[model samples]
Target: MDDDDDYWNTSETKAKAFNFDDDVLSTQEILAIGQKSYSPSGPSEESLFNNISITTVQSAAIPLSSLVSSKVLDLILLAQSGKDPSKETKYEPEQTVAMTLKRLTLGRSCSLHVHRSMKSKTELLDGALAIGDGNAVLTVVLFLIQTLNKKLVYELLSSRPVALNHYIAFLQNEGKISELADLLTMLGRSPEAAMYQYQHTVKTQGNNVDVLLRKLTNLLANHFNQPGVDQHQAKMISDYIKLLEWQKHVNKPDLKYNSVIQWLAYNCTHHWHEGAGNAMSPLTLCQRHQITPLQYDWVVLNVHAKSGKWDIVESLFTKKDWFGRTTISSNIPIETLLSRLSQLQASKQLLATCVNKVANSDDRLRLAHMYKIHAVVIETLAKQKDRSALTNYKMTLNPQSEEYILAENTLRDNSIKWKN
Candidate 1:
């Protein structure tokens, strides 16, 4: 009977649970025991809990409550104590984690268990501010996926709209971009339904947003290539691509100063993806939003020029035209006025017309600068002074006008280069 009692005591099931609260464990010892259970070479999250080493002399992770009960996990408890645990508004880590684990292990058999934990978690997250609980809220947002905690997902979106932007940024950093696409689209439709449906699918689908983007982009490109997809569908695909790109820059707090312009330039042109062709011009969207035509023109001008689209390049000069008895003048340079003035000859008359129609000292001064660029172009193209055109230009320049001085200053500069 003595031996039987001893054997019973020695059995693994009867052993006391691991207690990590005894001392500040050495890093090496913690790592050693950690390797035994968590597998040193194993995948992530198997690492020591938190920024602390609690692997040595442990049970199954100290049942979160005991950690809180022992004051070792007070941060978790403190965060919870800020709000009630039973309310459907706070986030209780211990109960939440336990409920998640139960749902994961038992599947549908314990779905109710996960829902209950989600309610507990909601209470914990309720009163917290955006930046304070941002990380924790995002962590739960993601973890609830594997936990299959839909209750928490709904609670988060419905009550914690404050953290939605940060939540997007978190998902972006984690490289789960497909989450956004799925969140924005569904056969079911509606933003709320799409939101929850996509959140629920995370654990099942896994992370491969990059791959999904490539494939989806490719699919859309091919679909649009078909004869009947229609321009509207093509525009939808383009907007989605732009939205995806914008999400990449979500950390930027402002949008009015062309933050998106640079990103769009680099993303769409740096790589030669056939799918890239499917992206519609951002200028089109900007126009729809009631932005001035000039702003759209400016963006296209820089982007196309930088990307080396010669046919689209237009030289700048003043332009004027007659309307009945009235004359209206434009500040736009000659090349810009003619629209597709890529051909050298086409630009010449365009330039002449602009020079003849100038109505002011400022316009004439601008014309002198225009003439200077013309002279250089002619010299390069003809290998001799196009004396007639040069003489005509000289005749048009007003020496004391802003045009002559402005043209002279620019002409004296050493860096001007003309390219087709």
Candidate 2:
């Protein structure tokens, strides 16, 4: 026995000689090991029930409940306007569905009476919004502000922004930024919903990107004389004579001539302002829209084309709107501009025009413009020119350019990768 004890002690000493820190176990693992010491088979049911308590669930956990009553389940299905008897939910299934299943199980009260006499919260909210019932609207909005889901509390907001805004303002009034992210994320994913929400948010918050761009332009202009050379140059180039021309054309009384005239004047940033002379001013609308620069450029171009800036279509291709279809530009007018641009090669204003108007829709005319652009680019490059109009135009107009073709190929490959 003495020899056995010495042998065990020697083995224990050798084990202790190793770095325990290197083989340290987590508290959970240590607790598991400790638990094995008593019963060894592992934790008994008694200990598990004694030591653990559930606090919360991100999702719900409904339990099997005969008390929920089949009749009540039928009523819920009917309430949802579901006619299919096969789709009927069972008492146990509600156990996992989020909500007060426990309360539902207490079928002691006449739930049908309660369910029928009182409209589910959603109907009440929708009805109130329909009648412009402020009290109901306020209550629903406050609840929405507090929680993303109004499944039980109120009806989900309808797809209309005006209608939705009617609710959003109510939420904002109740200070509901806390629970807005999930809802906003949903809205952002939905094109129409996002636009609606955007307009609503702008109306209520008044801190939208449209206001920011105006501030940026004004700030850049005011601080043009500052010490930083780059900042000053940005303002100078930005405020160049063409900026005014573009703005004048953009703001002209003839709404038909302007490139982008939204119902809201405050929203259209000077994205394609090719003002007097060849000097032009370009501003990005993507920063405000929360889209990629390339994606943003695509949206801006479409908006421009839709609006009327038939001349300012090239902004889609200037190393920004990457992968955008050059053929799409042919849909806009490139022929008329091509002749004017042919003579006007050596101006920054014209250069901006070239960049902004690179999207030519007419294939034959666009091809002609491409040829003219190519000619102008060769001349400018030979003379060591610094961004002539034709040079800028050539940079974007020629879809056949090696760089343009490469970018198009890469973009196409990426699209395939993502879709697959």
Candidate 3:
């Protein structure tokens, strides 16, 4: 019985020596031990955790309460905060490294996830703005364009100037010229959009003059001529359009001045000024391009004459004074007018009218005789009172003609002096 008790005591001693729970530890003691073993090493680990939490908070990268999609938010938060919402557990070392890399390259690592969600565009924009990321704001704008159409996107952006500006910058940087122009148009900034297209064309197609002119002309005809634009801007656009159109017409391989004249007349008479507010008239265009008055008159004369608008052609050379006395404008010489008119197959009555305006009788008689303006020839001979010259003029006329008879009657009246 002594040996049995000694063996049992030895076994109990051995068990006590090996047993981990020999001392009935309290909960606190157990917890303290566990913490000492599993706790992070220092404040650095705590600081990292706190920084991630702050980044997630400040970035507004997640909507914890909102019913909107959290995928984009979760990815952004995961990229920035190094925490995955899908997995609440601890990260493996490889995953931690990967997430760190993703954080380092934010936009490149994850493109925007623009999945359809319950959020309205305004709500999405607000959320993006809350993050204060320009790229994020632009991404939301693009998503808005895709989902709600550009029309609604414009309305939404109209209220959000900052976001609109950010998206503009993004489009410019990305070379999205057409989309940018469309946005500008939808915002009631069509003139600015037209100018943007003009600039773009000038930059890209400038080396090819024909192509450049074609594109610029089309833009002006279509967009720059909009009446809803500001008056001053419209005038500027009008002038530019005219310039481009003129260039296009003038640069043609087979250019005709008559065609140009007709084009100018048609535009000025109808399209240029009637309802086109601030558009330059043909005369205004001529002046702007430094065409001289005489050159313009010549062009006008020939153009009207060819069109059988003889009265308009005649009216162009005359001006009415304040007293309502109609006289030749005298901007062009009478002789030059007569010569051109004659070439245009002017009426004999027109020729006589021109001959009658000559102040020099000798020159008048000579021109009158040359043009066969018989009435002017006889009148000029009677005014000169040179019977010998009148007789010589009579030799050129048929004796039976009235002009010849008038010359003979003038000679017989001897009040006409013989400049013998």
Candidate 4:
């Protein structure tokens, strides 16, 4: 055995002496080495579980119902302890919805959980819309607007257009027009936003006239000056502002033509009182603002005339000729003035005054007959020596009337040459 141990020892001397052909082990020897090398299987389950505490074993042996009940108790105790205040107490879906909606009705901010759960938000919005509770809808939308990024919020509003409309209606109903404008601007509808502000300002007119005018001017200069706004619409707004300013200036007691008639008596009657710096005359303001002369004349004739300012009306048409005579240099046709004045129920004297301004006899006669200005008709007919026209004019009037009698005398006179 000692010799065999020395032979098996892995030394360089023993290794060199070993010959592979002569020292080859027999089958029984190889079998004996394999059997010695074989080891026991893994440890038994008893050894593995032996160190586990008896308490742990007993807990694992507990019934499934008891295990579940313990979990419930743990949850209940955790909730009562308020260890996690953010964790919701209610677990049922219906209860969660009721609690959220109740908060919204009281004008409270939406719960944070809805910010995470898309379905929850949709259901909440639907509930608000179903009941027509605008405040509630606004609450949810505002919450989304605050929590979400601009791109997401825009997508949300774009996809759910009803929510946007409800929000707009809520703002409008609350008279929060500025907020409404902001909402429109956020949605990339700036033109609508500008117009919205303009319409509201005009509609309310709650401010003083000067204050209102300033607001409109600000809108025209700043808001409507953007690239997307329509130039034509801005021009229209500018004209309206001009007209409003003109109307206000004209209504001033010191500026009214009747009030200023004495001033004109001594001072030369320059068009728009030309030399008066900072004058608010119709012609001055209109020309300065590029408003057309026709528009200025129309407003003066129609609006000022209705207000019974005949001096102002006459001053607009009154112009100086080379002979220093006052002539009615009306930019509008005399016929149009007559028709408009007639609709305004102007007196026949006023109508005849407009008629006598016509330079053409034919136009004057036709307008005079149409407007029943018999004096103009008789005068014009006599000047033309139209006995047939005079006779025809006589039959239309009462024989006892003065105008009819004059026509009869003119026709009977043979001293004047009567045209056939």
Name the best candidate (by TM-score).
Answer: 4
Global lDDT of each candidate: 0.45, 0.41, 0.66, 0.69
TM-score of each candidate structure, all chains considered together: 0.29, 0.21, 0.37, 0.46
The superposed Cα distance between candidate 3 and the true structure at residue 38, in angstroms, equals: 99
Candidate 4, number of clashes: 0
Encode model 4's per-residue lDDT on 24-88: one tens digit a residue. 44333333333323324535445647888655565333353543455444444454454553354
Q: What is the per-residue lDDT of model 3 for residues 165-197, given as tens digits with 9 covering 90 to 100?
A: 998878777778899899998898887787777
Weakest 10 consecutive residues of candidate 1 by summed lDDT: 376-385
Question: Which residue pairs show backbone clashes in model 4?
Answer: none
Off-target runs (Cα >4 Å) in candidate 4 are: 1-116, 123-136, 159-162, 169-182, 194-224, 232-283, 302-336, 339-350, 353-371, 374-396, 406-420
Give the winner by lDDT: 4
Per-residue CA lDDT of model 1 for 1-420, tens digit only, reads: 697787666758354334467564333434444344435465445454556565554535445453234432432343334533234254555435445443434432322234445455554344234335454555545555556544446445655565555665665566665565343333222343333323433333324445444644675555444554456655655555555554433433343224345544543344223342233335433433343456545554455556666344343222233544222244345446444333223445445554445545355445535555444333332223234433455456677676455445544445544231
Give model 1 RMSD, 1 decimal.
23.6
The worst-scoring run of ten residues by lDDT in candidate 2 lies at 108-117
lDDT of model 2 at position 191: 30
Q: Predictions ranked by lDDT, top down?
A: 4, 3, 1, 2
Ranking by TM-score: 4, 3, 1, 2
lDDT of 2 by residue, 130-229 (tens): 6554544555455444544454332355453445666556545665543443454355423332333333443453433345345445544543334433
